[model samples]
Target: MPLTGLLFAGLAHADIAPTESDWGGTGLLQTPSAQMAQEGELGIEVTHVSPYTRYNFTLQPLPWLEGIFRYTDIDNRAYGPAVLSGDQTYKDKSIDIKVRVWRESHYLPDVAIGIRDVGGTGLFSSEYVVGSKRFGPIEASLGMAWGYMGSRGDIDNPLSIFSSRFNTRPLCGDAVGGQFCSDDYFRGPAALFGGFSYQTPWDPLTLKIEYEGNNYQHEPLGEKLKQDTPVNVGAVFRLNRNVDFSVGFERGNTAMLGITLHTNIAQATPPPKLLDPPPPPRPTTPPQQPPEQVNWADVSRELQNNAGLKVSKIARSGSELIVTGEQTKYLYIAQGIGRAARVLDNHVGPGIDWYTVESTNESLPVVDTSINRHIFDDLLDHQIDLDDFQRSVEQDAPQPRQEEVLYQATPKAFDGGLSLTYAQSMGGPNAFILYQIAANYDAEYHFAPDLWWSGTVSANLVNNYDKFTYTAPSDLPRVRTDIRQYLTSSDITMPNFQLTTAHQLADGLYGMAYAGMLESMFGGVGGETLYRPFGERWALGADINWVKQRGFDQGFTFRDYHIVTGQATLYVDTGVQDVTVAVSAGRYLAGDWGGTIDISREFRNGVRMGAYATLTNVDGRQYGEGSFDKGIYISIPFDLMLPESTVERAGFLWEPLVRDGGARLQKRYSLYTLTDDLDSDNFDDNLQKITY
Candidate 1:
């Protein structure tokens, strides 16, 4: 029997399990294949093929969609003398998107359509449609491709039959590289390609054979390459679930090698370490007598040490006891409340049957959590369950009885810390990577309930700023493009020094005002107000700033450039896939009128993946490299990797290109983020952690 017939015959009775390589995405080699990473999975792959090297980061943010960012370097070409004296190789960045058009069934194949280099230079641009089906241990795929992938032009442009415009492709030059070339997409001649992957009995290995479509007749930088044969062979060796190594011989000539590191970001395993002890055991029966009077000072210290809450005041009204405090630790608000309940049970008088815990941050009231003493005791004693307890707890506004003040503790007025800091910038013409390491000192002081001062200073330890010499090619005012100057001009700098005050203006409205040096690039005074009803799905806010650009050394001196910038923003929680969309219209620092849209999805583990884009009145040509500003960001909560719980998080952002247009002030605070716990859904989701 033929190979196809033999594979089909085995499919009838063979029982085979899919392997690690089977789950890796398409385009494993140079040709299009049919496979996809699992949803929520993230992978980073590095591949080398003779004169070209590629670094690819892929994220399956959705089940049926995959987004990829690739940075490719032409090992033989220079970045021009202006950048590193022509010592560094030329690199190009591109984005790829793949969508599963159809999923496989018993009799149907899995089909996918993809576009490569969507908003990048035309060097590696292509579009393809592919399908694959599994038979026993073998999977096969076949596809038609166009653009760079189909440069061989074995078949005429079939689409040209409908319109002659599809017969010819246009070369618009490198200046328009990052703009989406919609007119050129799938417009050139077409070619056919196919591939198959076979899983052997050996568990760690999988073999691949592909028929590449590229003829190598047209190469980037005006070089024509030779192709001996289209057939290529390769094999992948799984190092583990998170890593893989592969090698291939392509075009019957050059050899290719690659390594991939992958993991499901949503399901990452946290480090092994000790956690806080569980809440104290609940009383089994009514107390025989009233509890002894304990020192309030001792109770305050115990609350801070055990529950990670700093008590500001303790008061009683009738049959209720109220504790106003700030949370210093614990990522879940319920955990803090649970521990506090136990502390209060042992300290408060028996007459106080109701407990009200009012939480605050930066001296701002966030939420008031009400707990019935009997319900908490019932739940902790196993007489009631979580759902029952949740139905009894009350979350509402703080209405402190001012008639009596039982106890009040002096708040900590000053705190500071020192740590090492690192900052990086990439994708600019000056260098592929520029970075600085410094010793950072941060301190904060609270003067009043609504006012505070905070500052951060850095002393440079090591850097490569000497290589940052390229000037930005922006026609507008150099609001942000002077970053190279700021980075190189300072060895020691004060990045932030500001005084801020916040107020609860009304029932659902909050306000903040900030002055002094806000960020490294600008010194400004600004005020912002937000209207967000507790637990509402939408919010509205506005901010205005009057600012002057800071000196290159990051000193207090002002620069010639000055402007007033502001924005009116709207935020909506879409309820689908935990996604949130934010839209803002504003006057930017460059005096351009524009708007921005930011969309992000937060996972249950507190990992956020999102992207934002800004479009201004500046013309595409004048906006330079990327036409506009756009980037992707990921925020990871510290508790995901740490044993001790914390509300802190770190963020990483990547912008394809930075220009002067559509730039806004990098403010230090936002009301929406501060008031997150006010959302009832968020509180309810965390109620399971309640123990006391």
Candidate 2:
């Protein structure tokens, strides 16, 4: 599943029904209402009513914001030329958004304004302001709409009183589509739509009645649709928490059947760990035994197997024991911290006053935390509260230690893993979904703690390349558009093989450099540096790379396309809701000068939802269908579903189209992501784990 839901999962749903309309919105049979599902809800609905069948994917990214992506098929129309689309049905892609205006109270109704079919081919475009109210087990909705949903022209548009520009509805979208036409919204004519839904005596059944405004004579494609009566009726049956089934009679003449699947992401919880060992029981008595001779090897093994820490070094200064290691598992760094403290309490001698754990990744230290051993012992003996222990802890950037070294890790030269990978291509001319299944094998050879050599091999196990016939035309250098060729070039390919190294340049500064095949389509050398103040909510980073396009076969061969691309980015945690904004001005892969803005927020469940758009010097017409480059990405922590805890994440990126205008090279790693926990906000969010 795409992990793009966030924040408001458990809000009350008593005011209105959490139902989908025939058009796949939260409402009645044919029109939308002001009611909305709980935030963080991701839903999919497929509804069919005569000449149309619609597939809708909706996400409530915010409590008041709902975004929908729809794929509508016209059963009566042909897709395109036979060679390009075969016998596929006509398909239309559209985007819709609704923003809440007011919440329902004792007297006021819930209200919202919305636009459908935004920036797409002119079909099914409409705008409306809807309000819904609930009384007992029944909910009622009323709204005024313009454009296709209001083609009946029941009255003059309300906006016409302000200006004559709101009196005419000119054509929207370009010949090839994908353009937003603000002038077309709330223009032309207007009509009223209203509906009511009643919850039945039975728990799972709800009945609906809607009065639609569209007469069905002025369809966008000029096809004539029939309307027996404006009144439509429907019933929804809730099958489970995440699924709904419905049947409806729409236009008073057509039959509609639909199904919806909904899931709340912000409320996601990982399943119980059935395979891992439990934490050792807390000691009942305080430490009274005198200090004993310690076997650091046994302690290191215990730390690795029981605490999920790959212990590399153990040192002692006075009464403190400093353990340095990588976290091999546990997405919640707090879990590791608590386990490490517990493990050390049992393994170390009573002389130790503080237990410190310095967490690193590939040998580069990111966070150093210290816990008062006495406070932990007191808490174990019921003498101190967890809050007291929390107050006694300290965290900072990795510190320079003058402790006597007790043990150092032996070099483990190499490590690797293999897994099955799946990839997809959507909205193609010939096929809606094209995919490939492959075996992914990757390995890392450690040359030193701060340096390593890594590479990955991908071999196709199965694919449907013969159906992949669409190739977008680009006037600029094809940095990313030529993906189809690369996917089918050979059964086996090497996408990346880079040598990377990093080191701390100063107190809050870090730097990393890399060379070799940077990605599947590009090979280059680049370096990135970041300055992240340990207790600040902001950071600055910059990167520069000189890259050349790789051959289709993805071997040790390069094409004659090369460019110098670089960027200086500013990252800020807005603090309003954990939203991070990154603004970057850079030279793109096609030599276009532009800036990209990325906004993202992490939910309570460790899912990151974000969207980004890039604007370059290229004009919309020359840049083609999607205009500028834009995409949405989702990163889901593996621990959410895995039996054992791990910090790894599965990621998904989606774009409406692949164009060459504002493309950037995909880096294997970034300093910002590598040193994320070093930032004050992230570290603090998980800091209380020290007392767990």
TM-score of each: 0.90, 0.93
Residue-wise C-alpha lDDT for candidate 2, range 145-228, written one tens digit per residue: 999889898889888889988888998756656667787889998999998999999979999998988999998678988889
CA-lDDT, candidates in order: 0.77, 0.83
Estimate the lDDT of model 2.
0.83
In terms of lDDT, the poorest run of 10 residues in model 1 is 1-10
Which pairs, if any, clash in model 1?
Answer: none
Which portions of model 2 miss their true places by more than 4 Å?
A: 1-17, 283-292, 378-388, 679-692
Model 1, 57-162: lDDT tens digits are: 7777766777777788888887677434457888888887789889988998888988888776657888888888889878888888888778888888888989
